[model samples]
Each structure stands twice: as C-alpha cells, then as structure tokens.
Target chain A: MFRHVVLFTWTEETTDEQKATLAAELAKLPGAIPEIRAFTFGPDAGVNPGNQEFAIVADFDNVEDFLVYRDHPVHQAAIAEHIKPIAASRAAAQFVFQA
Target chain B: MFRHVVLFTWTEETTDEQKATLAAELAKLPGAIPEIRAFTFGPDAGVNPGNQEFAIVADFDNVEDFLVYRDHPVHQAAIAEHIKPIAASRAAAQFVFQA
Candidate 1:
C-alpha cells in the first residue's frame, strides 16, 4: 500500500465553522473516489502541546491509485474550497508500505 | 482510538545509515511498549515535492495509552539517539477516531 499523511497548521484567522466544513467535505471523499482504500482525518486532540492542528492519513493500493485520488476533481475541489484558505503551514509524506 | 502522526525533515548532513538506524530503532518500539496498537512509518516516496522527508503514524486505545508510548524510555531513547540528531524540522498531530 501507499500511505499519504498530511499535517496542517491552521491560520490564526481560521474559524471553527471552516474547519467543520473541511471535515465534512473530506468525509465524503472515500465514497466519491474509489481509489482510496482507507482514509482518516481529524483535528488534533491536544494531547501534546505545540503539535500541528489537523491531520489526514490515507492509504491506496499503489502510487498510481494515490495519484488518482490526488487529481480527482472532488478532492481538488475540497482542497481549493476548504483547505487552501485556512491552511497556514502544511507538511506531507507519501510512502509505500505493506499493511 | 487516538492516532499520532509525526513528520520529519532530515538535515542536509543526514545520511542513509542514520535514517536506517532510526527506522530500525522505531521498529522496536511496538515490542517494547505494548500500548501501541498500530504503527507505520517510512521515508517519503517523492510523489510530491516540497514535502516532509519521513512520516510515523501510530494508534493507541486512548489518550492515556498514547501518552504511555510517548513517554516510554525506549521511545525517548530512540528519539534522542536517532531522530533528534538528523531531524531538521518536525510536525505532529494527535487526534481521536473510531477504527
């Protein structure tokens, strides 16, 4: 499998409503994009101080499948409409692994 | 479950041997600390540019279990001995979700 993980730090101006919207939008992706084998995302639980504010962890069958999800219109729309505006800093890693 | 995701960007001077050592050390944590329910980590696959170099994703039953793994001497030692030396930047997120 190929795993893609992203961490985002929200801008100070970002609102709770926007975050909620992002989550809602993301929750719909797996249904819309069948290439996604597994997906999990949420706001940080604050168990550790000074950590990123949100996370998205996804798994795909291979790099090609991951690319399909990456370029899917629904995913692109979510990123442009909900994620881009509030994102302050973002860090991501994509790697192949066996489940 | 509580999930912890951490990303690391290696320093310019970091070598392959150091990263391998880090991975080897990290692979031992699940055995040493029983609280970890799931763990996956690897160097980035270069699917995207300007992304972090490495990722670690872990799951625990709850916040307390997550904390136990976080503060475990073996984990701390791995961080101190392998991770800290080569890491140029780090970003992490810990969140809760139903598995």
Candidate 2:
C-alpha cells in the first residue's frame, strides 16, 4: 500500500469555528475521491512540543492510486473551496511499501 | 525510508500533565534508537473529528531499522516506563517506501 500524509498550519487569524467548518468540508472529500481507501484528518493539539495545526493520513492501493488522488479534480476542488481560504502552510510526504 | 507509525489512545483519565511527561519520554527514543532518522509526535486536537489521543511518525532507513527501533531495549524501556503507565490502546502500521 502507498500513503500520503499532510500536515497543515492554519493562519493565526483562523478561528476554531472556521477550522471546524473547514474540517467538516474536508471530511467530505473521502467519499468523493475514487482512489482513496482510507482518509483520516484531525486537529493538532499543541499539547505536544512539536504540535502543528492539523494532520492528515490517506491511503491508496499503490503509487498510481496515490498520484491520482494527489492530482484529482475532486481533491483540487476541495482544496480550492475549503483549504485555500485558511491554511497557512503545508508539508506532505509520500510513501509506498515494498516487500 | 521505512517507518512504523504508532497511534495511541491514553485512558480517558490520563491528564494533560502526565501526557506531557510521557510525550517527553517517547520523544527521547529517537536518539537512543540509533537507526531512527526522524520522530514526530503530538496530541490529536480532535477538532476535525475522528479524534484520537496521539499520533506519531518516525522514519528509519529501512525495514530492519524500523524493526530494530521496535524491539530495542531503549525503546522497550521507554515504552514500559513511560507508555505503559498511561496509554490505554494502541494501533500501528508499518510502511516501506519504494522507488
């Protein structure tokens, strides 16, 4: 299996209510994206020293499936409609398991 | 790189202070493991929903390195000393990235 994990930082101006709204919007993408096997997204509690704003873990069948999800129009729309408004910075890593 | 990602849920009674202490303990395992390249851990804000207690991402050179970290005395000691005292349930997944 292959996966892509994303960590996002929201602007300082972002409010809890807005974050909740965006989180709810993002929660809708899993069903819309065909290649995703599993999708998990949640807020980052600063309780940990290296805490950030949010984190995401999504899985796919393989690299191709991952790539499809990475660039899928549905995902792009979701990003444009929901994420772009509040997210400040983001980092992502892709991993594919090999035997 | 390969990684064994562990997701842990502390008992509901687990307090923030104890969780912080445990976080510091687990956070120290990376250096002692020798083979570990990167380690990141934080609390799940749960603001996005599907919330959990904590999530960790640790990277190693390969599967063997991951295994070494998993079973090493230093890691075991840390787990027993820090994690066992508070963690309620745990789930993990290992990934080996392919080129």
Candidate 3:
C-alpha cells in the first residue's frame, strides 16, 4: 500500500469554523473519490509544542491511485476553496509500505 | 489511540547511508520502548514534488504513553545521535483516533 501524509499549519487568522469546514471537506474525499482506500484526519491534540494544527493520513493501492486522489477535481476544489486560504504551511510525504 | 506523525526533510549534505541508518534505528523503537503500539517509517517515493524525504507514523494507547516513547532514553539518544544532525526540517502532529 502507498500512504500519503500531510500536516498543515493554519494561519493565525483562521477561525475554528473554518477549520471544521476544512475537516468536513477532507472527510468527504473518500466518498467523493474512488482512489482513496482509507482516510483519517483530525485536529492536533496539542500535546507536542511543535506540532502542526491539522493532519491527514490517507492510503491508496499505489502511486497511480494516489495521484488520482491528489489531482481529483473534488480534492482540488477543497484545496482551492478551504485549505489553501487558511493554510500557512504544509508538509507532506508519500511512501510505499512493503509490509 | 493517539497517533504521532513526523515528516522530515533531510539536509542536502545528508547521505543515503545516513538515511538508511536513521530508518534502521527508528525500526528498533518498538522493541526498545514498550509504550509504542505501532511504528512505521520510510523514505518518500517522490511521486509528489512537495514531499519531505522521510516520514514516521507511530501510535500509542494514549498521549501519556506517546510521551513515554517520545522522551525515552533510546528515542532521545537516536534523535540526538542520528536524526537531529541530518534533518533540515521537521513537521509533526499528534491526534487521537476515535475509531
């Protein structure tokens, strides 16, 4: 399986309502896109001082499927409408798990 | 369960050998620290241009257990001896999984 992880640091001006909207939009991806095998996302618990405010962990069958999810119109729309405006920074990684 | 995710961008000067060593040392954590419920780490596949070089997703029973693993001597030693030296940047997040 291939895993895609993204950590997002929200801008100071971002409101709680906006954050909830982002999370709701993100949660809709699995149903909206067939390529996503599994999806999990949530607000950071703030136990770690250096942690980003939000995180997503999604799984796909392979890199091809991951790309499909990445470039899907629904995902793109979420980025443009919800994520991009409030996100101050994003850190992402993709990897294949042999086991 | 509580999940701790960390994304790492390695310095340009960091060698592949160093990265491999870091992965190997990280793999030893579950055995060294009983608090760790699950651990996964690997190099990014580079399918995504914005991806960091490496990522880790570790799970624990709760935040307190995650902290035990995070601050354990073995984990701290590995960070000091291996991870800290070569890592250019780090993005992290901690969250609880309800389901």
Better of 2 and 3 by lDDT: 3
lDDT of 2: 0.69
Candidate closer to the true structure by lDDT (higher is better), 1 or 2:
1
What is the C-alpha DockQ of each candidate?
A: 0.89, 0.04, 0.79
**Worst 10 contiguous positions by lDDT, candidate 3 chain A:** A90-99
Q: Which candidate leads the pack in lDDT?
A: 1
Ten contiguous residues minimizing lDDT sum, candidate 1 chain B: B19-28
Off by over 4 Å in 3: none
- Cα lDDT tens digits for candidate 2, B34-76: 8988776666533333444676777778777777887899888
List model 2 lDDT by residue over A1-99, tens digit each. 565666667888888888888778777777888788877666653333444567677778877787788788878887887788888876555544321
Could you list the CA RMSD of all candidates, in the order they appear?
0.7, 13.9, 1.3
Give the TM-score (vs. native) of candidate 2: 0.52
Query: Which candidate do you rate higher for DockQ, 1 or 2?
Result: 1
lDDT of 1 by residue, B1-99 (tens): 899999999999999999988989989999999999999999999989998999999999999999999999999999999999999999999998878
Positional deviation of residue B21's Cα in model 2 after best superposition, in angstroms: 1.1
